[model samples]
Target: MIKKLIILAIIVVIAVFIRNSPYSEYLTFSYLEENSDALLAYVSDNRYISIISYVFVYIVVAGLNLPGAAVMSLSGGFLFGAGFGTAFAVTGATLGACIGFLVSRYLLGDVLNTKYEKQLAKFNKELAVNGYLYMLTLRLIPIFPFFVINIVAGLTKLRLFTFFWTSFIGMLPGGFVYVYAGSRLSNIESPKDIFSPGMISAFILFGLLMLVPVVYKKVKGRV
Candidate 1:
């Protein structure tokens, strides 16, 4: 545990420094839009470099708890097309989430558990019993930030493999939706364009599609 904390401290320090650096600006949607052509060309010309770059960027974004991950997901689609982009997004996101979860768990989970043992008991119980369900719900609806979700989940008793695989599977539908939309880049002006009213409504509809199972389970339990 001490070793984990030391490693986590190093990661946090590095993440903080990177977040405050100029390169952080390049993580935004505007930067992505302005350099879309160049980014695409570069990725195409150097596939291996692109993979490493995406992994690094994704890890940093997750580690720092940044907010442009949706844009990055879309950008992946624009750069690599739907199939490869979805694959890239899922792998990178799962890896990033693992890194965030590890750091959060290593650095803070023990402290939180010790400080709020009684309060956290119920949560820990729920996580242990229904970990997969909770992860699926979050991945499907994304009612919270992915990195934040990962960090919070780390505070619970969810197994590492459970967290990893559930996050990967859960995020798939939305990842595919966004990436598919990105592949049809003609209508896209900016990342903002991706979240137009229609698209939001569609996302809501999709969320409802996912919520059906949850609602059914609730109703059945009540019966």
Candidate 2:
């Protein structure tokens, strides 16, 4: 258990260090914007290779909790268009999230469980009861960072299949938002324009609706 926790801690520190270091410069919007067409051209020239490479890289990024996934998602939209981009990006993100989840579950989960057995047990019970609504809320609301969700969800008794499906479906609203924003890249001056206020508002409203059942569950619990 101690060994597992130490390794997990090392991995997270490495991820944070890499993200904060100059190594992550390539992930910035400036870098992406300056080389957009070149990137598009490369992918266009190597379609099958691009898909495989893209998914593989996304999995690595997600699993390791590296930086630039959001930018990568936008790039997916820019290079692949909405339909294909959404499909691939969502698949990649979900798969990557699962990888992160597994790492957390295997490495840190037992330690967390041993340390906080009672609290963790209660939390796991609740998660089993409302994993869908809770995950959907987390996905749509942007209340938490994706990598954090990926790691934190690992410390639970939640089933892997449930985690995958919830993550897939829950991510759709935000995933499509990125894809659509990415698809309009040619017309916009900044990549950030894809997250316009109106669109954000729409997603927030949708998230709130997804939370209805969670709220109901919470109220019932309190009662």
Candidate 3:
């Protein structure tokens, strides 16, 4: 309990520091737009360092459940182009999600399980049966908040490896889409501009496709 508390304290401190820090301003779309030229020049001059730094920052933002991931995704595309940007963003996001998941599991898993034994038990049972499909669907769908899924999955019996892989694969398409859009950042007025109704529908369609196997299995069993 002491250890958990200490860890929780550390997390809180980091989150507070980030929230209050002036550097937080750099996470905005306007900032990225304003400084695109300078930022691009820096990346061009220091390729390896830029990639490393970007990945680290991406991990921190996602792991901490901060608000800059979309901006960072756009920055990635703006700096690295779609192909490399998607790769780095997805890699960082998956790794960061794993960190969030571990933190949640370590801090609140036992307590939550004790408090909501029946509910968690039922959810875990469902996860044990189709955890991958469910996680994948959630990942592909943009409607669900990324951090919420990371935290909730921690409360379940889902394996770490399963969570990591599903998150990586599921986030790939969305990552690519965002990165691609970011490559055209000059034309974007707002982050909201990226997700038109058509784009959202496409994401939903992909998410639903992940459930096809489960639906097929259930129908076959019923027959």
Candidate 4:
């Protein structure tokens, strides 16, 4: 437990250090906007390198809870266009989310949860049973903080594969939405400009619709 805390602390320190360093400048929205044309040209000249770097940075940002992933996803769309952007963003986000999940489980699960293992036995059992569905609902909805979902999920006994896959699929709608908006980068001023009220409603409706089957199963079981 002590070792896990130490390791987690080390990871946080490393992440914070990198974010506060010179690399932080490029991660900003204003900087990206200021150099949009130059960035596009650079991507054109070094397509593969740019793509690799974008994906890697995205993973690291998300894993470390650094700022600007949403903006970065938008930038990816602007640079690579929607299809490639969504693919790369989703892949990196999923991988990064898993990293956060693992960290949470290591720091919170093994130590804290273990302390209350007996007390939490029943809740953990329920989580193990329907954790995927629960996570899916959270993923589909944008109301909650994405990082919070990852870390909270980690504090449970949900299987890593289940967390990874469910998060990947669940986040698809929202992720694609952001990446698609990035496709129209020239027309956008900020990341917040991407999501409109109509879009938020649509996301909520879709999320609820996805819940139908689970609700139906439960109702059927009750009957």
Candidate 5:
């Protein structure tokens, strides 16, 4: 109990620090646009160091559920090209999501389970049956908040491996889009430029496609 409290406290402190830090200000499209030249130069000069630093920052931001993951994905493309950028962004996001999942499970899993036993029982059963499909559908859909998925999944009986692989695979398409956008950072004038209506529609269509199997299974079961 004491240990859990300490972990929770530490998470709170980190969240507060991230919220108040000036560094958070730099995680904006405008900021990246203004300093793209210098950032590119730095990455060019220190390629290995830059990759490590970028991945580390991405992990921290994603793990803490900070608000700059999208920007960071773009920055990865801006700093590296689409190939490396997508790889690094997906890797960092997957690892970061795992951290958030573990933390939520460790801190609040028991409490939530106790409080909502009946609700969680159903949820757990469903997860046990089709956890990966559900996770993939959630990941492919941009409408769902990424951090919320991480935190909520932790409170269930979802396995760590299931969470990790599903998150990685689910986030790949979006990661590629953002990182590719970042690669063309100079052409973008605003966030809207990165995700146009057409692109959003494509993502929504893809997400819905992933749900086909799940829907079919349910229909078949009823039949």
Candidate 6:
């Protein structure tokens, strides 16, 4: 517990520093536009440094559940291009999310489980049966904050490995979409344009297409 608190404190300190730094300002698309060459040169001249810096930034972002993840995603695209940026961002984000998950579990899961065990027993049983599917679904749709998913999921009956793999795979498509769009930042007007009604409608159609099998099963069940 003491060790966890210490780690959490360290993470918090780093987050605060990053929040105030110039990188935080550069995280915006407009700032990135104004400083792309310098940013790219820094990344190229210090490849090792860039990787370490990305991991640190991701840890701070996910650890604190900060609002700048989208900006970070864009910065990744600007610095590393689409392919490498997607890989780096996903890997760093996942690792950081896992850390946050462990911290939350260690701190709160026991107390909540112990207090609500009796009332939650039935829900736990259901979770044990379908937790992996739900995790994948949440990863795809992103109804909850990434850090929240990490912490709250630890309280469920899902296996850790199952959660990890599902999250990793399920996050890929969305990651690709965002990173690809980020790679085209010069063409974009605003971050809000990324999820305009048309894009959302397209994603909704794609989601429905993917759900056909489950819908079939449900309809058959009713018959």
Please, what is the TM-score per model?
0.85, 0.84, 0.93, 0.87, 0.93, 0.79
Q: Comparing 1 and 2 by TM-score, which wins?
A: 1
Tens-digit lDDT track of model 6 for 171-219: 7667766776778777878887666476567667665655565556558
Per-residue lDDT of 90-180 in model 5, one digit per residue for the tens?
A: 9999999999999889987878768878876776777766668878888887566898888878888788999999999999989988998
Q: What is the Cα-based TM-score of model 5?
A: 0.93
Per-model CA lDDT versus the true structure: 0.77, 0.81, 0.88, 0.83, 0.88, 0.72
Weakest 10 consecutive residues of candidate 3 by summed lDDT = 122-131
lDDT of 2 by residue, 129-189 (tens): 8876777777777777887888778888678898899898888888888878777877767
Alpha carbon lDDT of residue 188, candidate 5?
Answer: 89
| Candidate 2 weakest ten by summed lDDT | 185-194
C-alpha RMSD (angstroms) for model 5:
1.6
Off by over 4 Å in 4: 114-131
Give lDDT tens digits, candidate 4, residues 39-117.
9999999999998988898999889989888888888788888899988898889999999998888776767576766
Write candidate 3's Cα lDDT for 26-110 as tens digits: 9899999999999999999999999999999999999998888999898889999999999999999999999999998999787
* lDDT per residue as tens, model 1, 88-157: 8878888888987886677888887688778668767656655577678887787887877887788877
Q: After superposing candidate 1, which stretches have Cα over 4 Å from the reference?
A: 1-5, 128-131, 196-202
For candidate 6, the lDDT comes to 0.72
